[model samples]
Target chain A: MTPLPRWADVVLLPLLNVVLAFLVGGLIVLAVGQNPLQAVGIMLYGAFGYGSGFGYTLYYTTDFIFAGLAVSLAYHAGLFNIGPEGQAYVGGLGVILLGLALNGAHWAIVFPLMIICGGAFGALWAFVPGYLQAKRGSHVVITTILFNFIATSMMGFLISRVLKPVGVNSDESAPLEAITRVPQLRTFIELFKNSPVNLTFFLAIIALFFIYWLIWRTKFGYAVRALGQNPVAANYAGISNQKMIMIVMAMSGVLAAMVAVNNVGGVQGRLILNFVNGAGFVGIAVAFMGRGHPVGVGLSALLFGILYQGGQELAFQMPGITREMIVTIQALVILFTGAMGDMLRAPLARLLARSSSPTGAK
Target chain B: MESYLVDITLILDSTVRLAVPLILACLAGLYSERAGIVDIGLEGKLLAGAFAAASMSAVTGSAWLGLLAGIGAALMFSGIHGLASINFKGNQTISGVALNFLAAGLTTFLGQSWFKRGGYTPQLSGDQRFNPITLPFAEQLREVPILGQIYFELISGHNIITYFAFIAVPVTAWVLFRTRFGLRLRAVGENPKAIDTAGISVTRLRYQALIITAVLVGIGGAYLSIAQSAGFNNNMSAGRGYIALAALIFAKWRPGPALLVCLMFGFLDAVQFRIQGQVFPIIGEVPVQAIQALPYILTVILLAGFIGRAVAPKASGIPYTKER
Candidate 1:
């Protein structure tokens, strides 16, 4: 089959997939006797209508951007890092420990240390699976899946037994002082009033550009892409596939660790049980929908951010529709964009070819 | 000594009970993976079956009807998986992941909307659940020596599905190794191209394998809600499906070994429950989470070839395409 035009491949195909996902999501709403159009309207208004709502959307978007970039970086290395959830969870330990240790320190001092420590922890968590895959011939997918479960069990123990403050009923660490916590954007900007959007949002934006540069403009990026496309050829070209896999996975873990920085440092101000809350899983859909491109990841992350904030509002407004409807939609997006991605390709290419043949026949 | 014997018996009995769902789902994976389909969505199918069975049993007040509905729900999920992987030639892993999320989201969404109980079906009772059946002379045998107590306490009182789970192992072994269709199915998984060249329909054999997978996994799901817990709760399969998948890998995709691995995992679970908050002779206090995590940790070790190599079917996770 003929390849699709660059524009079609990059933009049109993803847009069609998103549209198909929404159409099916709409059918789900309709199945439950809710008006799909009304649900969409509520979602749009909830996501962007007010200042605080838009702020929440951006807050959620920050998490997705990091998670998406994490998954995308691994995708470029032909690795599926499904343990981002676990990595992020373990990263919370670093963030919390640093925050607690520097409880009276200034936010400016505490924030960067949290990032470094948390990134290190997350990277270490992911590095194990990568190292195993590299040296031991274990498939990263299965090992990563197992790591997620281990993280859950390990984190559950720590939060409940090891870290919980004395006399505290909840399974959480001692909260950081307000001065030491990542300052919310609302403190400086009136538009984001009462929202949790913080400096991490800006960090997320910078990371997106940095990842783009790292993945596309660097020689290491070429090696990674070459490895992904054909490992044997990349090996013949002197790229150590094992070293590349390990480094790329560690980098992906660092990206995933940003979720912890966003949640524990920026919003929660303490380590809590299950705080990642499926954001890492959302990265899988985001990376697939974005086709593993930073620019596309940004757009899809924003789209999911809207769906999340709007879905919350819709659930409150429509008794029939619930928050899980967004999850269903997210699953559909993964299905159409990632799995059955090429189902429409042949027909679309045929149509484009037929339309352009008259002028191109010469 | 008598008290120790009783404790061992009790633990063994719960081990059998806990192993039932894992055994069934592992057998399910055996069939599907043997046909070269990597089904990570087994957890979702189990949850879907649990929800459907609980909802139907609550509404119809018949455990049999609930079982059928549960199987139907799992089959529907398998059909979606088949469509994506077999027909559209999509990424089998991604398709499985999507189906899993779909099952999770749809089950809870519908449960909340339909039952109005925060993603839970109504509590089942009497005919609405598969209650344990006592074997003949179980009461009479309980008063006898160790052998009689073992028969009565350890073997006599489980729901029918538990019995079926044990029975299905030998049946699966026979069906996989002794039948013509079984040979064809294994051939398709090993080398679909060879089967296709020999005039056999690889797709048909795979779909048949998936159908069997759906039935076994559905039964397992139904057993969770109706026999074990008496109703469906959100995410109630609680990673048993994934555990079963791990067991399948641990067994090297063989039916008999799959049963043993599941029982071993189940024993770990029972031991975890028994030892929680308890002190031991050498270990002092054992962390409950450590025991909970043992199965997964072992699976990773096995997969990493630290224990032994686990070689999957050659054609697994690759979609087939006919040569042009």
Candidate 2:
């Protein structure tokens, strides 16, 4: 098979896949007796036409960026960290516990401590599965999935029975003090009015750059890439595959923990049941769609954020279309970009080879 | 003593009911995995089947038609999985995950659009559902002795799907060990290259295996909406597909042991429901979530080889290429 050019592999292929996914999504909208073009218009308008909508889009994008980075880091280490959902859930415990402990502390002090505490907890949660896969030969995919269920059960018990304040009917912790919570961007920027976009959004941007550097520009990154490509070769080169797996998984968990910071610390101001709300799962699609590149992840995360914010508006305005339509589109994106990613490769390679051969002959 | 016996019987009865879907889905996974295709989308298939079955039954008012629709929906999902993994040589796990999300989203999206009842089908009854069937002499034997109560309560009244699930174990064992098709399926899973060398098409065998898997899981899904309950609710499969996957691993891909593991998990579920909010001696109230999480926890332990190693088929999760 002819290899694709780097540009085609990195950018063109992903764009094609996204286009295919949306085309199919449009067909689904048509099947449901709605005008596909109209639906697209509504989605685009909802996502970017107004200031607050764009703010919400960015807020959602922040969560996806962290989650996507988490998956991408582990992917670079040849690990599928499917337990981001679980890790993020457990990470909330850390954020909430610290927030409650320093009830009225300044936001500047509480925010950093919350990140450290939450990242540590999430890393610990992910580290166990990594250790199992590394030492005990358990497959990380299955263990991580089971861990998601366990985390759900454990968190449900804790939130409802242990953490819920007396006389409170809902399963949530006490609200953090206003001064202690991460300040929303709207406080400083007039354009992001009434939006939950916050300091964590900036953290997400920094994390993306940090991941790009850590995955490409460092010795550890070389080892991770080597391990991912071929474990036996990496082992022969004196890189401990076991150690790499555990560390990469922990790093992935730390990235995933940022979702908790975005939601619990930035937006909700309290730990609530199911606060993650499928954002971690959304990360899977984003990571795959991005092809594990920071730039790609950023763009795909923003795309999903648009779909999410827009889909809500679409559901409200268009009675026929529902919010789940976005999930279907996400599924299609994963299908095209991740699972059956190479379905078009043969034809694409042939076409490129045919077209380039004539040009290169000169 | 009598009340305790009655309580035990009731729990066992519910256990049988609950285990039926797990049993079917586990067997479905058994067929697919035995043919070297990892199906993580079993949960999605179950949910799709449930929605299809409920919707079809509501429309046609025929339980049998609902079963067919359920099977058809699962088969469609299996086809997508096959197209991606078998034909396209894509990542099997990713394909499965995609199918699951697709089923979840499409089911609800379509359900709410068509039914307008918040992702639920209309409540089914009468001929639209597979109601419980009382075995011969069950009512007559109710008045007899302790044996009569056991027969009447525990062994007599279940829908056809439950009976089929129990019967499927032996049938699967026979088909796997006694038939040439089964031998080819197992060979395809263990070493597709060898089967390919033996003048048998590995792809055909795998597709066949997947077809059987779809049929079984579809029946399980139908049983959920049409037999066990009245209609399909949102996410009604409720992770039974995953629980079945766990049972499949726990059983180490054997049908007989798969049944036992599913039953054990079902027993845990029944006990969980029974003991919820109930105070017990010494331990006080056992949190329902603990028991709910027990199967997953145990499977993790088993997978980690704390009890024993649960080895999968050699060729599972790898896309087979001619050169490879």
Candidate 3:
């Protein structure tokens, strides 16, 4: 059986998976007593339907976009960058440490530089496991997960002792200077009053286009495709498997770090220990649902953004639904999306079978 | 010397309790992985079991029933992993990760909704919870100089599961070594294609191994809720299942070695707990983070392919296809 056109897979496959996931996963949501339509409606409304919610939703979707690209970058080069949460946290650590050191620098260059540093820091942190996976052939999953625990604990230590935000008991670093804040119309941005939805979202869109271009248009993309399609083949074709592995992981880590940068510079203006909040991990789902493509991952991320928003509305309005339900949906998307390739193969093959075949091949 | 003597015994006793969960889980992993299934969802099953045990024990007021319920829940959850990965050929790691999230969410949701306890389940009474059943009060023998304290602390004051856990370790060894089924399961893991050609049903073996893994993990989960804490909290397994995975590797995937690895891990954990105040006091009262991290660090250092080679089963995570 032949595969779908690579072009159509990029455009339509993720949407189809998501549509199917929602329909199928609806049974699960209904079993839990949530009205799936209303729940989805509430989610959509909460994210983009009304008030400042749309801004807030897009704002976080940017982070999702960042994480999605991060996961996809690794996916391209045949690496599973599972330590995004850890990388993001470590990036946040870098952000606050740098922000503090440069306490009152102008937002233009200083902020952008810090953001780059955030990405660089995340890249470096992920490089540890990436290098290990390439060199020592350690299981990336175990190493990344182990790193998450260490990251959490290390962050806990840093927040409580070294970066303790004065007068606040919560585990967090002190707030960044107003000068360091990402430019945003926090005041009088009609409907969304206090949201930190700023230029970061635009940055995320720019990143998406850049990633899409990188994956499809460049020679590097060919190398990544070569590596991911079959590492052995890629190596046989004169590509450096070790180099690509490390580079792709670093790229994934950079994407993950962008999540931290957005969270600190725009939203929280400080590192919240809870900031990781599984967003980095959820990127795995986004990457799969998006089919390791930038645009698909972006839209899929928006779908989750809607879920997050709607789940909140449902929880608030009905008290029966829980935010955890949204989490379940997120996890379910990954579960179903991972099987997405298999799900399509037989059906697509059957549908597009040759005319000589009786009643279309099954 | 006296303090050292007491601390060592305490650590050993705690080691046994902690070891039960890890041992049972590693055994669970053995069954699945030995059949080339790579049950990464052991952690999820453990969490589901913990939740089921905690909730059921509270409702039924029977620790035994709760244990059974926990096992049933784990089996169901693990079955989902099996069905998705084995039948549908989904990515095992993603499925396992999803199960982990699902377990965390569903447990937390139910725990909060029904129990009104946020992320924790309702607390049970002494009888409802598993407690240490001290050995038949030996009046004179427990008074021996050094051995007495060791015997009392190490062997006595453990719930019934602890003793059963140790027993199961050897039983697992026997099953894997002495039994025909063990050989088949191991053969399937190492070379399922050969096993398939040999006329052994790889499907049946994998299914059976997964079910067995679920039940064992169920016991560990029950131990977590009913025996260890008597209350269910969100993510209470707290990566112990992964530690078991690490132990499985540290033990070279052998039952006896796995058991020793579990005990060593438990001892490390106990030492971490015991050294809460004295060791590097800057990290505050709960020194568990550094201590908890020790196993993972050791795993990386050990399996950085430095000490030895660890090769997974040839077709560990891949779904088998008749055509292929």
Candidate 4:
């Protein structure tokens, strides 16, 4: 059979899967005796209707973008790194420590330092699992999953026992000094007035470009892709499997950890328990749906950002659509885009092949 | 001395209870993975089972019927995973992860709308839940010292599902070793082509393995909602599935070793539950987080080859094709 066009293979298949997923979500809403059309409209309005709503969407988008990039980069090296959630949690601790230690420092200095510390901590956390997988033959998936739980427990300890404000009686660090907080997008730009969307949104955009170069344009990127495609062949061609594994995992960890900067420095300006939530896990689906491409990751992240913001709005506006409904919608998207992607891709490929064939016959 | 004895009994009792779910899930993974299907969606299956059992029991007021419903829901999910990974040649890991997201999202959404209690099912009551079962003469034997304590508290008083979990370990070992189906299942996992050439259907064997896994995982999940607790709360499985996966690895994917590993992990969980803010001699008030993180740390250590190798089935995670 003739191969489907690159555009169709990369874009069309996922787009169709996404549409079908939303359709299934609509049917689910209908089953619950709600108007699917009305629900969709409400979500759209909630996500994009107002300045704050849009800002929140972008804010969430930044988190997903970082996580999606993290997973996507790891995918390039044939590693399924599910440790981003853990990495981000550890990174938050680094950000919290840096913020507390540098309280009263200029934002110019504190901001960069926070990024560095977050990246370092996240990389450190991921390093052991990567090292184990590469050298000891441990399965990355299980190791990364175990690390997530470890990270959660570690974060709980640090926040409550050591990092807790003297008398707060809560499992959270003290609010960062105002000078250490990054400006919200509204303050930074007049067009985004009254929104919580912050400077990290632009940072995420820059990250998108950087990841694109890292994955597609560089020698290191070529090695990573080669390792992913054929590790034995890559090793034969002079790429060290051990070194690639470590570098890819470290890079993935750094990207995952950067979400701490967005949440800690930009949005909340304080370290709170579970601030990363499930965004890192959601990155797995984002990368899968995006087909491990930067542009695809960016687009899927934006879509998730809308769903998160709009789902909340939908719940508030129409009480029938509960917050959990949004989670179901997200699941449906994951199911279609990741698990059952072939439902669309296979048939579409066959159809495309048939149409493109010279004889137009089987 | 008596207080120490009481504390030991309490922790052991909790370990037995907590280990029930882990044991069942571990056995489920054993069947699926031994058949060459890496069932990472055990967590998703458990959550789905919990939600189904809790909601059904709440509606029908029959814990038995709730169990059936839970198994049914889990089977449907396993079928989806099988079809995707086996038939469609999709990435099994991705499918499993997607199944997890699906279960987490759908159960909460449906639970919220049906019961309107913030994504929790209505609480089960009386006959609607699986009450603890006392073995014959357990209370009469309570005065018999250590033997009495072990019989009554540690072994006898658990819910029926817990007893089944204990029984399941030996039964699984028997099925995997003594039965022809077990031999075929292991062969399919190791080399599907050989199984196919031997006049056996590889797809059928794998599907059957997954179905068994679904049933066992379903029971494990149902036990959590109906027996361990009164009803299902959102995300109630609480990563026990992953811990079971860790236990599976810790046991090197063998059924007999898996039981011990699960119990060990359960003991860690029990410690976590009981050891909060307790002062130890050297550590000086051990953090709850450290206790909670122990199982994962142990898993990392084992996987790092500090212990013997944990090898998977030769053909595990690779989709089988007719030609190759």
Compare candidates 1 and 4 on TM-score and give the better one. 1
Model 3, residue pairs in steric clash: A42-A310, A43-A310, A52-A191, A52-A192
> How accurate locally is residue B125 in candidate 1, as Cα lDDT from 0 to 100?
99
Who is ahead in lDDT, 3 or 4?
A: 4
Which portions of model 3 miss their true places by more than 4 Å? A1-16, A165-168, A185-188, A347-362, B137-140, B279-288
lDDT of 2 by residue, B1-324 (tens): 989999999999999999999999999999999999999999999999999999999999999999999999999999999999999999998898888889888999899889989889999999999988999999999988689999999899899999999999999999999999999989999999999999998888899999999999999999999999999998899889999999999999999999999999999999998998899999999999999999999999999999998999999988888874
Global CA lDDT of candidate 3, please?
A: 0.80
User: Which candidate should be chosen as best, given DockQ against the real structure?
Assistant: 2
Give the Å shift of residue A81 in candidate 1: 1.4
Q: Please give, for residues A1-362, the per-residue lDDT of candidate 4 as tens digits.
A: 45668899777988998888889988988998889899878888988998888888998899999999999999989999988999998999888889888988877788888889989999988887889889998988889999999999988888887777787976788888788877787875676676778877888899999989987899999999999999999999999999999888988999999899999887788889999999898788788778788889999899889889988898888777777666666667677777778776667878887667777655
Q: Per-residue CA lDDT of candidate 3, range B144-252, in tens?
A: 8688777778888888877778888889889988999998888888888888899988888889988999999999999999998878988999888888888887777
In model 4, the runs with Cα more than 4 Å from the true position are: A190-194, A356-362
Q: What is the lDDT of residue A285 in candidate 2?
A: 95
Which CAPRI level is candidate 3?
A: medium
Q: Rank order by DockQ, top first?
A: 2, 1, 4, 3
C-alpha lDDT values of all predictions: 0.93, 0.93, 0.80, 0.88
- Candidate 4: lDDT over CA atoms? 0.88
Displacement of the residue A282 alpha carbon in candidate 2, Å: 0.4
DockQ (C-alpha based) per candidate is: 0.81, 0.86, 0.56, 0.74
User: Could you report the Cα RMSD, in angstroms, for every candidate shown?
Assistant: 1.2, 1.1, 2.8, 1.6
Best-performing candidate as measured by lDDT: 2
Candidate 1 lDDT, A61-171, residue by residue in tens: 999999999999999999988888999999999999989998989999999999999999999989999999999988888888889899999999999999998999989
Worst 10 residues of 1 chain A by lDDT: A137-146
